[model samples]
Target: MYGINSLIKSGSLEAAYPLHSGTYKWTVSGPLSDRQIYYKICLKITNYEMPRTEMEFDSSYIYKCYILDCINHFGSLMFFGFIMGRALDHPGVVISNPVSEAFYRNCAGLSCTFEMAVLQLTIWFVRSCFKMFTKLIIPYLNVKKRQKQHDSKFPNQKLRQWESDYLLNKSERYRIAHEYLDTVAEYGYVTFFISSFPLAPLCGFLTNIMHLRIDAYKSITLYRRPNAKKVPKLICFTKLLQATTYFGILTNAAMIAFNSDLVPKEIYRMYYNASLEGISHQQFSKIPTSTVYSFYKYKANEETCYYNQIRDDNQNKTLLYWWILAIRFAVLLGIEHIVFLVQGFVAYMIPDVPYSVQEQIAHQKKIQSDRRETEFSFNINRKKSVRETERFVLIK
Candidate 1:
């Protein structure tokens, strides 16, 4: 009954986390004593008469949160790009400036800004990679645990679908990690080669650095992810690996801060969750406790129950890691456009700095200097002739 309860509770937590964050109540199938429910209730009970040690929110949920973030950040930035492009050609903004030079200069600035944005995008990519790698480790651990449990149940062995799925998910993660590495290389190389555009040359270098930073995170995943199932030890030595990765990320962040000039502030916000830090623990505690209470309360009624006893497509749909890469690209593009808009507005507010415009401005300055020098010489010659004539008259 406890094992059944645990299964039901796990399923309930999985279902609820993606949906809501607050108080919810439901009923269970079995006729259980209030004592059982008292033992089972894992959620926060503001009413002290019904005491419950709130189960900590699963840290694992962070994987999903990160994925959603990746989606929102990049997807919005992509739309912003289209707006910036359209705004550049608008009659009001286009007509006010020296048309051709202004156009090229603005476009060039846009290119530079984008090159800087790659750093933020790269950090996101790495974070996703780390998350996926951890997922793979988890499934592998699950498979092992399942294997030990299975041998006791049946002497003759046939592998189950869950085992197969775990293996498949594991293989997929490895393949995806390699793909990310390949992409990092490709983007890095191409960014290095392009030099004709204003910011093209910096693109390759910045991208390479981004890839290296992300790749470094794999070490952390290898350490932390392997131990997801092992929570008993006083200090999981494996966690030290995660700590190392954290340090690596901090180091990378610092390097980007000082060494790389291409990072944009908006893009950086996407990587770290400012609102999450304080709220994270409270958020983490609710899921498991809530799951135990809710699943037990609703187990008997199939119509009301959100999860099935057996794994099905609905039960197994938390594959956000698979789609994370595409989502990040979309979000990064949106962030880029927003940054560009802010920058353009700020530049418009401040007085234009000297020689920041096109080469034509420098040429015009040179012509004006030449004209003034020529006029000064002509005036000096006229005064000299008048003085010479006056001397000649006095002598006569």
Candidate 2:
């Protein structure tokens, strides 16, 4: 859709930077080390860095400037999550020997809970920022017609030109890799700490609403206004999404298997334990809803005692739990690999450009080649005519 839209040269493509070859220079003030210079210049010729030969900065309005030298982008997000998890993870202080009934929600799962909460929050925050900022600014970008309107209506207004090479811009230095970095953080970094967090979707709802207005203000006064560049695709983002989806699947399975004690034992025992015994599943399923409560962990201590659940032949239980978790992980891992192969096969079979579009492009290229050839022949003929006339004059 975006490719077709951009093919029509629409202003909506402003969210994407042109994928072209161009000279991009560093205009940063600080003494850049040799390695830093190499990475910034040689490595990043064409990126969000330099969409054009020159990028103009807009300083008509003032915005907040922070000394981010002390701030580590990756560390900050990770630490924020860790701190939030720790701060909110108070499950009635830490108990040395916790007691949990098969009926009770085990609080020992706080670590997993904290880990999931942190990851979900981080993912949602990054998502909110990306979606909000990208949507708000693309409209007013180098669409000539819109720029003309802004000029006619507000001649005195000063607009921020595109800060493509924002790394050089000390004030907005973070903008350089903000989008990609955020996605990496959400999909890659936090997931490493723990598998899955269910609250991400819920958290995204609140952040999206708030970021809508925040980004609107930021676009008008804060960020640079670059001309609309056509985005062929978000290849990187799509990869991230795919990778995260696979991870989410495996992570959810792990979370459920591990956190069984955190939820109702009936859920775990009836469903998970059912797999261990064929008869129990049939028996449990045949029971009525109201009477099913009677069939639950009717044990004298298993219903009220966490230690009884944890310590009673706990070695066997621990081994079984781990074996189940490992089996689940392996199965999911295999499925991911299969899905990846299938996706690659499908992609290979499918061409990015449709046949009709490819034909149109080919026709346009042929027309251009014919026009150029005719112009070249005309030039040669004119030159020959001039030479012949000059020779004839010389002979006379």
Candidate 3:
């Protein structure tokens, strides 16, 4: 029955049929008088409860989590390549000046990343508190409500005791699905918009480290032992990770190229020999004398100064704008190709199974085959000896 239940749960079987627990009745045919017979039978099957003392933690889960963290970190670095590679902005550029608004916008990404990290942590903390509260308090309230409906004092006492025992047992059981969902959420949060903040990996690491400790403490003190489940692989999460990897590469490339000042700075440095300060001063000097009504800010501006790096000729994008735009696209394409090539090279170089492990697996298979052959020969010999001994005894 346990095997059947396991098979059903694993999707290897449709159902276990014709087995039930109930009173069965049938008419007796051989009796002197027609009589009906009734038999009460009950068959119950349940999962073998894993004891807390015997629970073996799988280290692969931890390794996978760290691997995901590393990926997110690396993706963030790639997204903000200028931080490590080259100086994109001028050294003395003032962040507060309206002319340096582009640089400010770039810096805003970092701020957003930090904000998101805080938000994720706060959400996890609140969720954990709520879960603990409901687990401890809700069942007691339910028991109290049931107690009010029972009128007899003695039965109520027995009922309360049973309810207390049930609640204690229930509180000990851990819901693994909740943990799995939490991990998934954390993974998504770190990987999906990682380009917006290069420090996301750091935040993720701190969160995961704390989360690991909390989970360990809960398992030890608050929750009962969880059932041991055997899974071939984390198939769903593995696929999700693969998809995220590809998406991250593309997303980081686009983010660096468009969201940051890296491309424009490069274009300005290579194509135009003028300094950003000089250009800003020239644009400011050329500002129209006529007062312009700015509806967005609801203010009248004496000078119509453009904060963007585009040309001020009739407010239309100049050749430099198109050139910068093209360069950005080129950078995006180049990054994707280079990253994918490195990924392929690394994957090819690293075999999933090491040579040592492969040899051990082969040796085990060989031993099993040899044992099976020996057993087969022994079985044949025993059958022949048994037939001969029977024939000899009959003849004697």
Which model scores highest in lDDT?
3
| Cα misplacement distance, residue 180 of candidate 1 (Å) | 7.3
Model 2 has a clash total of: 4
Tens-digit lDDT track for model 2 on 1-396? 212233224432111111112111221112111223333432243343333322211110000011121122223333322332332211122323313221122222222355345534553554455455454444334344455666788888776644222311122443433434333434443343344455554454565467556655655554454545454654244555555565545545445544433332444455666333332222111211222222133223221211112112221334444545465556556655675677689878898789899999999999999999999999999999999999999999
**For model 2, what is the alpha-carbon lDDT of residue 46?**
34
- Candidate 3 segments exceeding 4 Å error: 1-165, 168-174, 193-195, 220-228, 274-301, 309-312, 376-396
- For lDDT, candidate 1 versus 2, the one ahead is 2
Global CA lDDT of candidate 3, please? 0.48
lDDT at 190, model 2:
39
Per-residue CA lDDT of candidate 1, range 138-229, in tens?
65566567556666686587767544343332332223323443343333323321221234335446655755665455343322233233
Rank by lDDT, descending? Answer: 3, 2, 1
Pitting candidate 2 against candidate 3, the one with the higher TM-score is 3
lDDT of 3 by residue, 261-347 (tens): 676555555656445434332222123424322222313343443333355445455676787789889999998999999999998
The lDDT for every candidate, in the order shown, is 0.36, 0.40, 0.48
Error of 3 at 336 (Å): 2.5
Model 1 stretches astray by more than 4 angstroms: 1-83, 88-135, 151-396
